[model samples]
Target: MLVLTRRKHQSIMIGDDIEITIAAVEGDQVKLGINAPKHVEIHRKEVYLAIEEANREAVSDVARVDLKRIMGQLGGSE
Candidate 1:
């Protein structure tokens, strides 16, 4: 991992699109401000992991469902 020390208001750029700035430092906590395009997604690591896990579980459940049987029950054509 590439680690760099940045003081408050200092910024680091990623590629040509994203900018990560050190907004504030208070005791042990550091606040960051990120500037990026609207298409870019930003999430905390734990939140991202949870979303991935939930998606996996949803896919697994969907795989176990019988789509044909449900369609038949609804009187829909195959």
Candidate 2:
């Protein structure tokens, strides 16, 4: 893990695009502002984990479904 100390208004660049700036510091909380392209996705750790778990559950549910039977029930033939 890369750790660095940044004062308010100070920023650090990731590559050529992403920039993470220290917006404010109040007591024990620190606010950050991130600047990145629209294509980049940024989510909190908990939210990301939840999304991953949901995706895993969806795949598991799909695996348990009989696709061929469903298609046949819908009057479709392979």
Candidate 3:
């Protein structure tokens, strides 16, 4: 993990395109402003994790249904 110290109005660059800036600091909360290309995706860590979990669950459900179908075709119990 890369650790950086930035104050309000300060900024950091990621590669050549993405820039993250410190917008405000209020007590324990810190606000950030991010700039990137339209093609890029930026999500909060928790939101990203939830999306990943949902995707995994969807895939798992689809695989289970496929396996059941294959098993029924083979004259096996689902």
TM-score per candidate, in order?
0.83, 0.82, 0.87
| lDDT digits (tens) for residues 1-78 of candidate 1 | 999999999999999999999999999999999999999999999999999999999988887686756877788653
Best by lDDT: 3
Q: For model 3, what is the C-alpha lDDT against the true structure? A: 0.97
Ordering by lDDT? 3, 1, 2
| Per-residue lDDT value at 13 in model 3 | 100
TM-score of predicted model 2? 0.82
Stretches of candidate 1 exceeding 4 Å from the true structure:
66-78
For model 2, how does the per-residue alpha-carbon lDDT over 1-68 read when each residue is reduced to its tens digit?
99998999999999999999999999999999999999999999999999999999998888768675
Stretches of candidate 3 off by over 4 Å are 76-78
Error of 3 at 22 (Å): 0.6
Error of 3 at 5 (Å): 1.5
In model 1, pairs of residues that clash are none
